[model samples]
Target: LQEYGLVSYHSLNLLKTQALALGLPPADLRSIKARYSFAWNDQGIKYLGITLPGKFEDIVSTNHKKVFAETKSLLLRWRLVRLSWLGRAAAVKMTILPKLLYVFRMLPVPVPKPLLNVVHRDISSYIWNGKRPRIPFKVLSAPLEDEGLKFPQILAYHKAAAIASLSESLLIHQPLWTYIQSIALPGHSFPGLLFTPSKSRPPLPTALQITRWSQNVMTNTYSPGPMPHNTVGGS
Candidate 1:
């Protein structure tokens, strides 16, 4: 078949020989290749905006820095314009929050506490025009009906996004990602495995770590008592 393919093999020489036998030109084959190496300095190549085979923490940290930088630039520019408190809040919701929410949804990882604090501080400064705040952040985060500004709570929103991702994986039957994630979770049903305690569960792959962490967080937050183990059998 004359189709694009990805080959993973132990021996590069063996792979090259097979490719030649299959009529794949050396130049065409060499043009696209990624080999894991202990001495490699570069991060994995980007495919569809994700850094393949890179550490999940590194990806999250990179995106976090980007989002913070972009938001800070926007806030500085907006400060030049005269806007009411309400208008500032609207600007943040429309522009800044969407960028953050996108990252939260895409990665679904537990954001570092220090990173979250930094974002919260910068966003607070922007909202208050770098002056002492007249209203508390918690009140600002409340809905309009409750006499508040409906400000985005970064930590809450991040947790919600992680929970949403977990829900999507659980509710969707045999999702493509589940198959890949399941490779690390042999013989365990995804739904039941979610209920298994962190100590009892095996070390999860990077992609599923946030989902598992979010599950535990939700259980702790909402459950009246300790959650029972409910691990189901079969892969």
Candidate 2:
């Protein structure tokens, strides 16, 4: 158009002339299709107020919908199954665990205990027919040789996933991790090594912001007792 703020798009000969006619800055008239190369991007992929393809350190998910919805759908449908105890265990192993892992692939944080407990309640109902199990849950969690179903523990799994995600940035020395460390933990190093900044040296605002944001994400993901809070409002 003749006058517009900024609309990023692929380059063509006419568009360049139009941009010049509009008196837009030369720097503003350009394309990134080749640079980005992101397919199936109709909306250009936005996250955390920044446009994609953003930094690895900026990718933080605050809530989960896909995982919760899939798990809930499976749990609800599982009610109609008329099966024995061990048979029910097989059903869970086949139907539920796979869905859980599917969601866990995208979910980088540990799900809250209260939310996970509700799912576990649905799982408990499916397994024991809404009756208190003869064996304790801790015992029920044991391996087959120890005479247990080796049931999936949601909280444990979530925490493990979170730890694994943290390790991506903290332990593994990938290119993304290296870039993140330079910004996030500039002074700090592994094995408890950190150099103090001098009067001339100072922490960067942008780096500190990203670092704190990442830390907050990990902080929010904590494992707790298997009890859904009473104030959990859902019908």
Candidate 3:
């Protein structure tokens, strides 16, 4: 109450409405306070300083834009002075990759392919002194011993990151998976969802995108004995 100097009248009204939506009476002090929250702006609302959005996919896409912007800034630094081919490769692998890894590890949502291409362009321009790449990207991205530089294809990292999220609960089979199962997946099991092929409509963008990516990672990495742990359905 305003008399107690705890909260403003406007905050109290917002809390009251939110509490009512949860089927709690506004008069209940516990419910009122618990429902209390503040928005940073009209476009964003932060709870405890965390910006959770209406759609799950927005979180990933928004963060990726930020990563891209920061990477772009870094890339501009080298626009005037191009690094050696080896030096540029190292920067891409080391400096740029980690910026991506931070968000990729945190959220496994689909990243737009074009955004990755933008990063690739920056790296390529820096490497060749603003000239186009002479070698095919596939050849240039090969391992060091294969008479080519070892540049990590960002998409592969995206797929692996997505696979890591889907395989998280499957690998452990923890109680937390109960929450995942409850989320709009009705009759589908996560194992069948990932391992079993389906033509049915995808449940969520995260689910669909991650499944497609997992398939790609599995197909690309399939070999004798190397896939001992990740194998499913004998393939």
- Ranked candidates (TM-score, high to low): 1, 3, 2
Top model by TM-score, which number? 1
lDDT of 2 at 79: 69
Clashing residue pairs in candidate 2, if any? none
Model 3, global lDDT: 0.62
How well does candidate 3 score on lDDT at residue 138?
87
Off by over 4 Å in 3: 1-51, 80-82, 173-178, 182-188, 199-235
lDDT of 2: 0.52
User: How would the candidate models be sorted by lDDT, starting from the highest?
Assistant: 1, 3, 2
**Where's the lowest-lDDT run of ten residues in candidate 2?**
190-199
Per-model TM against the reference: 0.70, 0.53, 0.63
Q: Give me candidate 2's TM-score against the actual structure.
A: 0.53
lDDT of each: 0.68, 0.52, 0.62
Candidate 3 differs from the real structure by a C-alpha RMSD in angstroms, to one decimal, of 7.8
Q: Which residue ranges in model 2 land beyond 4 Å of their true spot?
A: 1-63, 169-175, 190-235
Q: Mind giving the per-residue lDDT tens digits that candidate 3 earns over 86-194?
A: 7777877888888787777766666778888887787677777678777788888888799777778877787778667666656655557446554646766655555
Best candidate (score: lDDT): 1
